[model samples]
Target chain A: MYQKSPTQEWTSNVVRYKKFSGSWAWLLHRITGLGLTAYILVHINTLASLQEGPEAFNAKMQVFMQPHWIFAAWILFGLVLYHTLNGIRIVIIDFGKGAKYHKQLLYGAVVIGLIVFLWMGYIMFFGHAEYDFLSMIVTSYN
Target chain B: MSYKYIGSRGSGSMSWFLQRISGIVLVFVMVGHFILMHYNPEMGHSFNRVFERMQNPYYQMLQIAFVVLALYHGLQGVWNIYRDFKFPSWLNMAVLAILIVVGVGFGALGIANILHF
Candidate 1:
């Protein structure tokens, strides 16, 4: 009798399976998908604060505009950017146009993501004095 | 006595198709939303600004549609991931039921908030 061992199965499924570009892309897609879904649920609840009136909602917004929270917001932005770009890649492949150049598409998505991220990051962190203005209004809205 | 359900396996393709459709819709709606919220923070982040926006029937409709599409896309993605785990049939059904309840609950709450204005 011959049988595969549990450790070997784990290695094959978990370790080696993640080595390729496609696998890495798949893994990142799954992570970003899950993260975005979780964010949507929380976002709805936060928006529901409007039922309590503007003060309540503004209070929540104040917390969200804090420096640490702003960093998290940037990370969330990056995740959505990556997911959206990769999603387009997936759609192109599904349309049967880029199956052979899938690897190139993945790399192309990453390069584009980086470029957009830098541009957005600069605006978010520097180009907008209005970011501060908005935070002030949110904090003082009550 | 025993019973079995027929054609339980046919939903996979339907879900796959729906996910892609919802993803395309989300890409447009979400990018619009992000630009509105971040690119124009002064107009988007103020309580008065949001209140004003929600007052418009068209804006409310857009928000409601966004919520519905997002919930469907997100819940479908989560369900697809769970399917890969090969859970037992009974547990799978339980998970699906829970996901449905949560998805519908959030969607209703979101729509109600939009309509509240």
Candidate 2:
């Protein structure tokens, strides 16, 4: 239960709230959910270029293939990965006896999410023929 | 008299169940999507590749279904979050209408893109 003094304001109340780990998970899930939903709308609009023929579509796709865009896409994948993993945890909690071990489930999700995120980053950015700079970094380090 | 929107939904058992079901389905689809689209960035990023893939009627159908299901799930999730706060019933109804309109509008756009090939 949150008590707000007359001067405290809603933002201050939230800023002062003592958040547990689960609260962070809950908040992140909501933030990512809303963001992904908005993104899907834009994604559909972007795909509408398909009707304009190959020249038009390829031009647009080429822009996205740039390194900056790839970086952005990789971040988007991270959010999607978190949402998907946590979603499974939620289902387990609701349908099975996971409530008792919910914290463990959250930990498991984070661990797995981090590993996959790194793996995906490798796939997206590292050891790339097109990304000569990235490949150069790897070789130079080796 | 406040119509008490909470009671009208009957605990939202159906939406909750549907949300779980949709989430489960999305996990599988997302795996395939990532593998197919990002495995070789060219596999999905290029117009030629996408055009070729869209030639398959079955792929087109599946993609259309993916669009519909994704929009439905996302919008429903948003509505769930919206419901957590205390808003008047009129505002709630207005938001529901806007979400439906957005889903339908973008759904049509997505389907049209997939089917264009």
Candidate 3:
């Protein structure tokens, strides 16, 4: 097997690292957006299953309550909170809310993102499993 | 010296405006969505109720519009971001082509689902 010399390998790694890190923020935003959208579709599909009858819907909800799904839900919530809060930051910055306070606001977003993420994580982890599905779909259903 | 902005005039600005407008609209849609899908005891966990709701023309049109704006805005944003990278033009074209196809495909399917109701 042809092998790269240590010097060549180092340079290649540095180039790759620079390319990736340069766009890391935007890349993360896009990835999380895609992930969140996919989750939304799945969520809608699951709710659509409610058409099947009470037992079938209950069974599906049970699967959703599995540990793995719970973990995935928490992660998804964190991504959403991060993306939404950061998006607000972007919009505010666009409106010139804080030119001198740009970095401060960026840092504030990070902190707030973490806080919102923790709140979501807590609800997913410890809150009662009582998210009303029908109410989410329509007021008439009530 | 005239630096022509890529989005000076065309569908780009129109799409941008549509995205923001639709995004604001989605907030209301989602509020109604959560109330009907999650809170209503009759519809909350019942699949039949959901189908019945989707059968309404107003709801279906709202869904179609939502899906269209989302795809247009999202794909355009993604494509613009990709321009920042220093890649071969061919590679860029390939990526853009795939994105366009996927966007249209998903948007079509989402609308189709609404129309099916």
Candidate 4:
């Protein structure tokens, strides 16, 4: 058995965890930003292809609608949810919400990210576009 | 801005600026994108509609501009994240060079795809 003092071990772990948390937040933000940006490039360019004809447009659209792209879509969607929620958390912290409240807000951000990610997952998987706000009223309970 | 209050305008400052600018652009782009893709997807999603839009010289120009800006902004943000890790200076520069090359290469391919189509 490793016989390190518990107090020393605990303190070291706390410092390590703190470093990890900050790095994790920074890393997630960067990754999400990149994914979202790639999506933007593909999106605008693909839309630009509409100039060719419906056949060309459908071919491009099919690429995006494929299974692999759908998976990428979910991942990018989740990243967006996390990045935006965590960004708002950072903004709150920046505005002088300090000490205990800041940590509390960070936890709140994680919860919000999870919720939004689940919603996105459901929508992406469903294939139907009913999840869009305006579409629901017209399609359902009319 | 005072030196103490203002942050270093080195890599960090540049990265910060790029992220903010790109994020702002995305807000407009994302909303427009979703509307075009999902709202009346059947109509707007057609290639002919896309061709019509791109056929407009102004839209074509804007599309090119948008691609360049998006790639620059995103790659810069990624570079900033990579820089956050303390690495050897040479390694940092190499990584940066690679990112630049890849970004530009992708941008070219994307442009070609749009133009040729």
Candidate 5:
């Protein structure tokens, strides 16, 4: 008879290495990938509303344009940005192109990802605000 | 634990290759989608605007390709993560079935919508 190990459970193994950057990245990648997949399903279904004509689709768009939904959209944007940047790093690493500078590549990706995230947040909030400063300057020139 | 054969051996390599290819394709399609739909939401979120864009043959083709590629890439990614966990054979089979059903169902819906437009 074969004997089972105490650490054989998936949860235990996941818990053990949860703190490492690599592990955290792996976990987040899976999570965000799953989230994106779910979003794709919802996205397609929502688009299907187009078949019903413009009114129905516009109504759905209005719902999506609500504040909470807009917040969720920003979150989705951040997730995609991170995933895409990290995915490029991963692809490069896979090709043995950046074997020596893997850690630097990851750090670079994180830095870039952070900048994009904050920039996106700024655009989402301040850029669209009533007193929109950036647009004010641009329109003033016009 | 004993294992059951789900399919032919060496399928992992095929999935890995397809994932990379799809990922490359998605980089372009998804980025275009983000710029169009999010960065310029004024036009994208409007039904008439989207309907007008969808009327273009090139845009329709892009949407179809994006739908198919994204579905394949995402489903394969889920399977890859599941494989890492080394789930029991039955559970693996179950997850595979679920991914297939969901992926195909959603992909079909997306393609149908594009065709209808």
Candidate 6:
């Protein structure tokens, strides 16, 4: 049987490392970050319809107003929520004393992320249909 | 002889620090964005609705900042992830250049959308 040399041991070990909470967290953070980045590019391009005029933009947006697109947006929001919460945890661990309690921070982040994700899901699916009081603060077009 | 892969780049302490700061700002802006876009789909999807909001110069400025920061943070993140692996320096430079182009290109489009209002 061939064996890795001492110099290559560290790299091999990391590549074949066991999965744990921290590993999962790191992987998920990267995954969601990449997905969100890709989505941003697509979002920017999609909104370019505005340059073609209101009818063009409205027609483009009309496609996304469908239930399927709404569902997709909800899932996208889930990724954003997870990424944001974990980002906060990363900041705490790096800038503050959260390393000692990093696991707990991950747990807290997951809990809060879930709550926000579900709440946003509700809003994307149901709350958007009617006039929301809080929405009025930012939304009012003649 | 065993082959060892030493990275060919400097320690990116500045980018590391900025990533955290930009991430923090993104969270706040994203929250407000979610409220405005998701809370009322019409406000998000309708050009007239967004036009009304974009009429405010401050709001337009905020949106431009959002685009720049988001692009920077996201592309910088891709570079960070790439750094984790041992790639040839040319590939690294190429990837970095491409990320810059994507950031600038999409950034212009996002700003255009806002300015079009």
Best by lDDT: 2
lDDT of each: 0.83, 0.87, 0.60, 0.64, 0.79, 0.86
Model no. 5, DockQ: 0.66
How do the residues B1-117 of candidate 6 rate in per-residue lDDT, one tens digit apiece? 112222344578889999999999999999999898888788788888888888899999999999999999999999889888877766766787799899989998898888887
lDDT of 4 by residue, A50-72 (tens): 55667766988866654456557
The order of the candidates by DockQ, greatest first, is 2, 6, 1, 5, 4, 3
Ranking by lDDT: 2, 6, 1, 5, 4, 3
Clashes of each: 0, 0, 30, 5, 0, 0
Measured against the native two-chain assembly using Cα atoms, what DockQ does each of the candidate structures obtain, in the order listed?
0.71, 0.81, 0.23, 0.34, 0.66, 0.75
Q: What's the TM for model 3?
A: 0.62
Better of 1 and 3 by lDDT: 1
Once superposed on the true structure, which residue ranges of model 1 sit more than 4 Å away at CA?
A1-8, A132-142, B1-8
The residue-level lDDT of candidate 2 at A128 comes to 59
**Taking the tens digit of each residue's C-alpha lDDT, what string does model 3 give over B1-117?**
123333233446565565455555554554465446323334544556656777788877887776776566566666656665666656766787788787777776666656655
Question: Least lDDT summed over 10 consecutive residues: which range in candidate 1 chain A?
Answer: A130-139
Per-residue alpha-carbon lDDT of model 4 for B34-95, expressed as tens digits? 44654454544456666667677776676676677778867776776665566666676677
Q: Which ten residues in a row have the lowest lDDT in candidate 4 chain B?
A: B1-10
For candidate 2, give the lDDT of residue B56: 91
Off by over 4 Å in 6: A2-16, A129-142, B1-7
| Model 1 CAPRI rating | medium
Q: Which stretches of candidate 3 lie over 4 Å from their true place?
A: A1-27, A37-62, A129-142, B1-46
* Interface RMSD of structure candidate 1 (Å): 1.0
Comparing 1 and 5 on DockQ, the stronger one: 1
Per-prediction TM-score, chain B alone: 0.88, 0.91, 0.70, 0.76, 0.88, 0.89
Q: Write model 1 residue lDDT over A21-97, tens digit each, in one string.
A: 98889889999999999999998998888888888888888887665676688899999999999898888788668
- Candidate 3 residue-wise lDDT, A1-142, digit = tens: 9999999998998787754321454567678766766665555455554445658877786666555665676676667665665555555555567555656666787788788677655554454346433343355345
TM-score of 2: 0.90
lDDT of 2 by residue, A10-105 (tens): 778788899987898889999999999999998998888888998888899988876678889999999999999999999999999989998999
Candidate 6 share of real interface contacts: 0.90
Against the true structure, candidate 1 has what lDDT? Answer: 0.83
Which scores higher on TM-score, 2 or 5? 2
